[model samples]
Target: MDQNLKIELGKQGVFVTTIQELYNWGRRSSVWPMQFGLACCAIEMIATTMARYDLARFGAEVFRPSPRQADLMIVSGTVTKKMAPQVVRLYNQMAEPRYVIAMGACAISGGPFKQGYNVLKGIDRYIPVDVHIPGCPPRPEALLQAFIALQKKIDCQPLTGAERPRFLDAGAQGEFPVPVPGGHDLEPTSNRGVWPVPITMNRGE
Candidate 1:
């Protein structure tokens, strides 16, 4: 091979790889979550994607029905023990680099149904959860925050085939620090009041 031709081909390869990475990043940023609403929390999940909260601003408002097409899964309601297998199957059907957001207290830790014989203790038992929104039904803003947190986690994650620092290994103690709860002394804010807030609609009468 001609030396110059070989060098040119190498440059082309590099360009293609860079372009592919950029495309992947764009797709990940604009994740379309599968809408798997099963209970009360579904209402709040819908509101988060609605005009007022505008999940579109974060590129997460696109809700897909098919698991294969969605980049993320939002478990927005109680997952019954009987429903656990189905949830796992749906999660498995999604393409690689998928994420799961356990929305609401129910999905996170079974909420008030923790004692229920039929309710799964938590959706986390069935799927690897990327974010947990804590509330009987978390406010739209809380869900949005969870999405933002998920995005941050995605950004920090190493790309495939990249050599991560040895200290960053999952088993490496101190390298991975668990976040501490700052304190619970502060009065709890009413998250319910944050939801269903009237949005100004100007419809000509």
Candidate 2:
């Protein structure tokens, strides 16, 4: 081959390799989460990203405070009617390929607050949702599992077909399923005027 032709082929090879690497990187880092913590479920959401569960193991630990920089928003608690507009604004601010995970029964379908006049029955009434984590306060593991489910859905999403899989299905029937890890059944912890022990961050001061 001529010297000039060889050099041109080498440059083209380098360009193709760089583009391929960038494409892979983008896919790996596609889901950037906006940390929109609202109530109890927020603690579980933080735990998922913390040292124990470590959401970073799956490339989803990037928790951006600004919606403009995020592609996923984990709505981690009850969204009241008063806050509906703000939620919509935040969802709109996110870049394309955005996703929302309603990270509690409250966010998914108002949880125990479904009868409240002030609380929004479901987040889907306003903005689109991608995953729904069912629990009054779901465990960190469950949230991480939901993240993985979200990733799978994103991967299998059709480019030109109908929109992505929606987490909430208003037409679906029955109560949200509660996940019981370690084969433990959920038992009510309190009785009338009896308070349960507060969850401590550490054992002692």
Candidate 3:
């Protein structure tokens, strides 16, 4: 509905809204995050829910201990290759309409540990990340900002159409392949569909 029209209708004691609007409104309002963390960034994430920061104001205060009950996963630390598979598996267990926020430089690209053999370059290599908060360990304010950004993204998603989000698209892949530990590295390196392998062409050829 148009903004002016909605206001005019309100003046006339009338209200109208589409199902899509209602659905999106509810979904964006109550995004329960999983209560899981891996490193230093977890401290900032914890602070976000405390009195001063008060993440509950956004209606996302409820942190579920189980993946099955959560819609949001805040990967807020370094993702070592050994733990990458477990993270992906947990994501797979979450119900439809799941979202991920890669909070801090560590979760986004391993931060100072990027070159370390054990640190996964980025969690997105195995699972899709909807929001990326860039900081060694992003402040609570940054996490709140990221939360609002994710809400805006949910609000704009279309309920129907080929371009609809993966959760709403039946043909979309339901589970990502969990990488297995190989001799030198995590086998497959990255999820082909989530993060496609870069292709290079030989100029001489």
Q: Which has the greatest lDDT?
A: 3
| TM-score for candidate 3 | 0.95
- The TM-score between candidate 2 and the true structure equals 0.66
lDDT of 2 by residue, 1-205 (tens): 3667657888788332344345435654557789778889999988888998998988888889898788888999998766766776677677665777888999988889988866766676555577889988999988988988887766655333345233233343212222112232112111112122346813530
Query: lDDT of all predictions, in order shown?
Result: 0.70, 0.69, 0.93
Query: After TM-score superposition, what is the CA distance of residue 79 in candidate 2 from its true location, in Å?
Result: 0.5
Best by TM-score: 3
* Alpha carbon lDDT at 101, candidate 2: 89
Off by over 4 Å in 2: 1-25, 161-205
RMSD of each: 14.8, 14.9, 2.6
Q: What is the TM-score of each candidate against the true structure?
A: 0.67, 0.66, 0.95
Clashing pairs in 3: none
Candidate 1 per-residue C-alpha lDDT over 72-122 given as tens digits, one digit per residue, 9 for 90 to 100: 999999987666667767876776557889988888877999888666667
